[model samples]
Target: MAWFILIFSGAVEAVWAAALDKSAGFTRLWPSLIFLVACAISMGGLAWAMRSIPVGTAYA
Candidate 1:
């Protein structure tokens, strides 16, 4: 479960990057919203995984 969460976090980070790029300096509403939401989910998953996994490993 920790591994899954960690991986999910990583995937969300990637998606978030793409969404941020598409946000057009946050002037675009939908993509900006997606970026913010994805950022929250990614950080939440990272924190959840930290309960079982070390920061370095979870980050990697």
Candidate 2:
């Protein structure tokens, strides 16, 4: 389950990264918000996983 969360988080990171580009410096409000939310969720999940797994292993 933790591994799954980590993988899902990575996917979310990709989504936010693309959305950030699409936002174009916060000019697009909705996309920028979406990117911020996604990034927060992704980082939170990653932080949770790091509690139990080694950073390198979680990344792997």
Candidate 3:
């Protein structure tokens, strides 16, 4: 469901934010990779969910 993907994406966004902090300016390899991958998944999920959900409601 679109709502499920949107919620999952939002949760991943938190992981992305935390991994970004752990990345140490991208100096740390593992955390940096995690950040990059999380970013991709979060954005991709948002895009996919948007196909079924309206942008305004999804954003809210």
Enumerate residue pairs that collide in model 2.
none
Show how many residue pairs clash in every candidate, following the order shown: 0, 0, 0
Spell out the clash pairs found in candidate 1: none
Please identify which of the two predictions, 1 or 2, would achieve the higher lDDT against the true structure. Answer: 1
- lDDT string for model 1 (1-39, tens) is 999988888999999999999999999999999999999
- By lDDT, the candidates rank as 3, 1, 2
Rank the candidate models, highest TM-score first.
Answer: 3, 1, 2
Model 1: residue 9 alpha-carbon error in angstroms: 1.1
Q: Deviation in angstroms for 13 in model 2?
A: 0.4
TM-score of each: 0.94, 0.90, 0.95
Error of 2 at 16 (Å): 0.5
**Candidate 3, run of 10 with poorest lDDT:** 51-60
lDDT winner: 3
Report the CA-based lDDT of candidate 2 relative to the real structure.
Answer: 0.91
Tell me the tens digit of each residue's lDDT in model 3 across 1-60. Answer: 889999999999999999999999999999999999999999999999999999998877
Which has the higher TM-score value, candidate number 2 or candidate number 3? Answer: 3
Mark the regions of model 1 whose C-alpha exceeds 4 Å error after superposition. Answer: none
Which prediction has more favorable lDDT, 1 or 3? Answer: 3
